[model samples]
Target: MKRLLFALTIILALNVALAANVDLDQLDIAKFSLTTDEEKTINFEETEYIITTDSITPSEIKLFFSPNNLVITAKKEKPIEIDLNNDREVDFSLTYLTNLDAVTTIELKKTDLPEDEMDDESSPISDLNPKDQVNDILASIKANLKFLVYAVIVLIVLIIIVKSYKKRANPERLYSKAEALHKEAQEFHKDGDEETAQELYDKAEELREKARDMENSEV
Candidate 1:
């Protein structure tokens, strides 16, 4: 009875695995647009898409969007609504076949400015009032000041951590000490002091080993 139950479980798992394999060519984007245009831009609150597949059920379909602001799922022929959280235009959408190495991409249309208005070559600064321009400059400086302060703080913290790590395990210092000891050993050997030369060579070897260990630990 136990063997029979195990066989049934394996069959069930295989069936589920087979159901998740979807073909990219079999999937189609039937429709993709905003449900309503409250203004000139596409409405994020009512963005809709209609996806279809030749064999895969809607439950098996998965949807992904970038810059990853929206969380939505695909439904059968029915339209799926998405909230983009802001009025900014969507860049693109991606559809993934779950457990299958298949993907589909859809590029969204960007909001367009009137051609006549965009062709104007006059500088925008010319239209701004002197007082308004000063206020805008001040606001920009204020915003950047906060970011600059945070960046400096982060840099200081990183420098402190790096200095602390080097103090604990300095491979360059170990290597330099090893090289000095090796030179001293060579000089002692040249002077025919065999015992002192051997001792210095042993100390150099130990320092070289410490340097190698420090380098390996970092990796």
Candidate 2:
């Protein structure tokens, strides 16, 4: 009985040791995949794809990982925003919204992934500083101010041009009214109607006054 009990105890200890010391020296390839058949496809725009749950019956995503050592976390539009790609690893907040039915997707991803995408070692772009990697963005007000100023200048120039054209196209302008009145007065004088010509001359003088008034208003 003692010998049998000793053998069983040795077997259990070896089993525990084997589970504890997994061979991690070799490269373990792991993947995270999602497939949708409910007519919602993922198009991430830049060779990558987005997984949407629109018009689907169940609206669920599947994840597959390898090595069984990775960790998974999920949230529906977490309260705090994340700035990814600074490091190869992801940092998720514990305060994420637990509800999965939000409009924006709930990203459940594996943070502990292999640093080397391939089995072979690669370049040192991954060692860059987070600030150096990040790009500076302009303020919204500054951008809108540029567009607004351009629009206002264009509007003012158009108004000035339109007002100038209206001034030149008046009924009492040089060519349209004064010249016509002069011709009419000359015709009346040539017809030997002196009294009519005097009245027409007065009318022409009134038209001249109107022209002067229009010019003064413009200046």
Candidate 3:
């Protein structure tokens, strides 16, 4: 299970990395979001926007989305710096007429920047399309949730008490048989030997069924 989790983590990391690529010429994005005219009028703090564009020229970027449609300069970069880099400073802004509230997505493109102005840390947060990033995070959250389910299964297994010994009335007998079957069934299932494991499971279940019948008959 640990190995599986490690593999999943690696895959998630790789996908995120690939999604954040800033190849502007080809124009792709990790995710996107939008802002309403209501939001456009207000200044937002820590609020995100999704933007979409078919093409981006150095002088101006043409947009064809909903809520707002306008051309904005692409020559300058839009910088919305946050605390993600531990810099504790706001150091980015885009000098374009394109309001995030009016745009559906931000098309990523390749660009050259001087060393002093380049910040790679914000690349992942800014470039990823909003929806895709949300999906990735949700998937990671789901993977983590599996551990909780495993923990609960363990708790229930641990709480199992076996304190009777009257042959057909013994709880220990039933639990022991069950544990043995569970282990074998899992191994067999992993090995893709479902038919044999199912047969064994059926036999173990038959024992349990007989015990249940015995208890019911006595009652």
Candidate 4:
């Protein structure tokens, strides 16, 4: 069981590593504009997002997701950094579009930095479109495989317990049969029937082995 758990951990780690190596080209680049009092919602197979620009402070952007919410204040020229999966990588960016001191309009876009410019410790978050659908399918299959592994382990353990219980139930009966075979072999040997005596001895040994196994069986 310990070995099984170790193997499972290794497989999980490998899967995570592979998933982290996402292709930037496969991701859909998002670009949109939001004015004061404007709201937009985007839905994907795996995740959903609802965003709005504050009416009073247009630079303040609000993103809605399940169980959590994120709000950011954008600045002119400097893009607002977003790390949705908390991997320290920038997945989305927001920036103010006006030169005036008062905020008015904001633009939402994908991270524009080159892959080489990103931090070495960074990993991209799962965004929308074909990539999101693919991720959802892979996650579903991984969960199913985990369930199957646990089921098979349970079945094997149950079979072992049942077999051990059967062997332990009537060990005395096996020993009695083995003693009878041993006495019969001795009688044949005393009658000068060497070949028959040898065969009988072999049968006696087999019965004795069954008795020993039954006695040693653990449930």
User: How many steric clashes does model 1 contain?
Assistant: 0
Judged by whole-model lDDT over C-alpha atoms, candidate 4 comes out at: 0.54
TM-score of 2: 0.25
Clash count per candidate: 0, 2, 19, 0
Q: Report lDDT per candidate.
A: 0.47, 0.39, 0.45, 0.54
lDDT per residue as tens, model 3, 129-219: 7985786566544534545565556444433422122444665577578768877887898999999889878877876786677667667
Q: Which of the numbered candidates is closest to the native, going by highest TM-score? A: 4
Residue-wise lDDT of candidate 1 within 74-122, one digit each (tens)?
5433333334445464422333323222322222222232454333324
Alpha-carbon RMSD to native, per candidate: 19.5, 27.1, 17.8, 17.7
lDDT of 2 by residue, 1-219 (tens): 235445655665544332221111111211122223321211111122223232322323232222222232333333222223234444322122222333222322222334443222232224335653331112222323444565556556656766786777575674357667677888989999878877777777777777777778767
Give stretches of model 2 more than 4 Å off: 1-150, 153-157, 160-163, 166-176, 188-203, 214-219
Model 3, total clashes: 19
Q: Stretches of candidate 3 above 4 Å error?
A: 11-47, 56-175, 178-201, 205-219
The window of 10 residues in a row where model 3 has the poorest summed lDDT is 36-45
Off by over 4 Å in 1: 1-122, 129-131, 171-207, 210-219
For each candidate, give its TM-score against the true structure: 0.27, 0.25, 0.24, 0.31
lDDT of 4 by residue, 32-114 (tens): 34444445543332454566554334334443433236666565556667765556777766555553343354444456556
